[model samples]
Target: MTASRFPRWVYTEGGEPDPRFTLANERTFLAWIRTALALIAGGVALEALSLPIQPGLRLVASILLLVLGLVSPLLAWFGWAASERALRCGRPLPSSRLGLLLAVGVAAVGVLVLVGVLVGPVGR
Candidate 1:
């Protein structure tokens, strides 16, 4: 009996890639997931903790972090699939499109936190 892989779409088309490369791709996916979890934790912490920052800015930063967290898993899945497909098809690995966006978002969150800290709690 043939054991079927879960993602038939990814498994069906291309030749099998080296196990090492596939393992590496899986590791990358896990790393992205870890990052997503960290983002989510940060978002939760911002709201749950009573830090002395502007509430509005803190909420915005938290929302942005949560959004990034939500999107990271999609990036991880699509990135792993695309890379695995390319490896199987002997094509060059595709460059990440959303990575830059995520980086910018994280930077924006940092800036917002900085501004909130600097501005302090207003009208509290």
Candidate 2:
């Protein structure tokens, strides 16, 4: 879908909220995209590195990171949309559930990588 066509769900809701809040939401979404891009890059680098690493474990770590990265943008959109819809509807803003999920995901990835470094095979 086109960039413009994306986030079409935003328009299907109630009337516009404050511009500042909308702008804040847009900024938060952009930040999440940046973070997702970084995670993908880290995953790629981990997989591509020439340093010694066990194939299966490194691959697992790589996959975990990559998957998290891929999921984040979608979460961002969902979070942003929900918040916007709430704002328009005058409902309480939703909690930051995505943040906790990401935190846990990142911690898991880190643990996997650490284990890979400490116990997995080195250079291919």
What is the TM-score of each predicted model, taking all chains together? 0.94, 0.85
Model 1: what TM-score?
0.94
lDDT value for candidate 2?
0.83
lDDT of 1: 0.91
Query: TM-score winner among the candidates?
Result: 1
lDDT of 1 by residue, 16-118 (tens): 8899999998998999999999999999999889999999999999999999999999988999999988998889999975689789999999999999999
What are the per-residue Cα lDDT tens digits for candidate 2 across 4-117? 544667656677789898799889989999999998998899999964666777888889889989999999989988888888777899987579878998898888778777
lDDT of 1 at 66: 97
Q: Model 2, which residues run further than 4 Å from truth? A: 1-8, 120-124
Candidate 1: residue 120 lDDT (0-100): 90
Candidate 2 displacement at residue 48 in angstroms: 0.4
* lDDT, residue 101, model 2: 79
